[model samples]
Target: MQPYFMPYLGYFQLARSCDQFVFLDDVNFIRRGFINRNRILLDGKPFAFSLPVIRASQNRPINRHSFAGAMELFLEQLRHTYRRAPFYGPVFRLVESLCLEPDMNVARKAAASVAAVFAYLGLPLNYSFASSHPAEGLGGECRILDICRRFDATAYHNAPGGRHLYDVAAFRAAGVCLRFVKGSFPAYGQPGAETFVPGLSIIDVLMNNAPERVSRMLDDYVLEHA
Candidate 1:
């Protein structure tokens, strides 16, 4: 999976479902995707928050992009937006540290957020970026296969959304098992909202629930063999 900007709960669930997780950062970035943006709660509704990327393009890899925005405003917005949240104090500090970090590389910054969340909850972050090992010129399932081979992995777990894109027989031929992880965001209380908004950034989750609660929610997923 590509590095996302503090993605939804299911993103963490997908990572938890696997023994090893790799971010496909070397692949071409997707515009209007979660690469540099995510939804958050504001005004009792889902508000999209995005990190402005310098010359972000679909042609370039995610790791090639750098953030180009006012870090202070972003942090302030988060502070003001979630001030009433129950766990906002600690959650804001975590998000503040991530946003205020000197490293502006979008992929690294986003991965740092994910890593920070796991670290906050005392969970092991057993993951790496695909660019760490070059499987240059390979894309799609071929690139995934190359990654699995590089890691000597026996199984490949993907989000349910891409279940149609893979060929189970091909993975079997390579001596690997392919499965799709199905996950749903277990609804939690969001201040001032009657209808729970699902799929908001993990920041929302952290702000609304305790770290221990969020850690338990990570296991809300099932794996289906392909």
Candidate 2:
């Protein structure tokens, strides 16, 4: 999957399910996609937050994009939104580091953000950037198969949405297992809201729940063959 900015719980669940995670950073950027933006809870409703990308275009791959200076705005927004949240201090520090890190390339920053969360929970991440392993001139499933072969990965796990894009029989024919993650995001309390707002960034989860509690939530998913 392409690296997403502080992605939703389902993203983490999918990552956790994999033995090796590969970011599709070489793919063309989707202008309105979650690659650089995601929602967060603010004022009892879901608020979208984004990193400004310099010269973002579908013609350019995600790794080629650089983030413009706007993380401070995002950090302030998080501070205001989750100030009263239960696990505010440490979570804020984590967010601060994620945003203020030296890396400004869109793909690397997003990848590091996910890595930071895994580190906070003491989970090991064995991940790579797709561009680094150049499957040049290949596209779609063919490119994915090449990646699997490079890693000697017997199984390729993806989010539930991937079921539509991949064929179980074809992958099986390639000596690979095709599986999809069905994420169960158990509802947790959020400040200033009685009705739960689901699918916000992982930052919201960390803010409202302790790292240990959030670690348990990572396992709240099921895997099935696609």
Candidate 3:
């Protein structure tokens, strides 16, 4: 549940369905993963927006992609790209404030920017980064179960992708119920689209509509079980 590149509405839908959400920042980043890039519709076409990360050593993990000297340029690029969008004025200022803050840690800056976006959209879920947790040798179901235990969560909810990776029966044995979130398309205000495109990055919604309207769009998303 990392704060990926302005994730789609389904991410927030799953977040609202859960009691507490964990940002899995300590995990390795897959090179082609959604960690630093996402797609959006622009000028009636799909385009990818991405952030550049410092290349890591061969032994270093993908999640270790760190911000290098190019951070200032990256922020400028985002401002330039988003400046003309509907809510870009306030959003750019907020992101710039965090990005340009003197001596701020890279991860903190990223997380703060994510929090700011969610705040503007009125999402109320609480968040914590995995790096802040105590060291433990847990992965797969055990890792999720541990979070549930710590928070006294009766159910552990995950995105649909976890079905192949997690054991539902094992979690039930440990007194935690496992639930997978099934995503549905939610309507949004987009320019010149005959049919709604689902799963475009959250920025698509933000740039096309106001904050209040975005909140209402999020409220309209329906969740189903697999």
Tell me, by TM-score, which candidate is best.
Answer: 2
Weakest ten-residue segment in model 3 by summed lDDT: 56-65
Give each model a TM-score.
0.96, 0.97, 0.81
Task: List runs of model 2 lying over 4 Å from the truth.
Answer: none
Which order, best to worst by lDDT?
A: 2, 1, 3
Backbone clash numbers for all candidates listed: 0, 0, 3
Query: Which residue ranges in model 3 land beyond 4 Å of their true spot?
Result: 57-64, 69-84, 98-107, 192-196, 222-226
Model 1: CA > 4 A from native? none
Q: Which pairs of residues clash in candidate 3, taking residues 3 or more apart in a chain or in different chains?
A: 28-63, 29-62, 29-63
lDDT of 3 by residue, 1-226 (tens): 7657567777766776776778776665666667666777655566676666677433443345565534576566555556677777776666566556663333555556567677887778688877666447886567767777877877777888777877768777888777877666557656655567768877667776788877766565444442
Ranking by TM-score: 2, 1, 3
* True-structure lDDT of candidate 1: 0.87
Per-residue error at 210 for model 1, in Å? 1.0
The number of residue pairs in model 1 that clash at the backbone is 0
Compared with the true structure, what per-residue lDDT tens digits does model 1 show for residues 109-163?
8888888999999998799999997975788999899989998999999888998
**Strongest candidate by lDDT:** 2
Clash pairs, model 2 backbone = none
lDDT of 2 by residue, 121-181 (tens): 9998889999989976999999999999999989999998878888778799999999889
At residue 123, candidate 3 shows an lDDT of: 77
What lDDT does candidate 2 reach at residue 207?
91
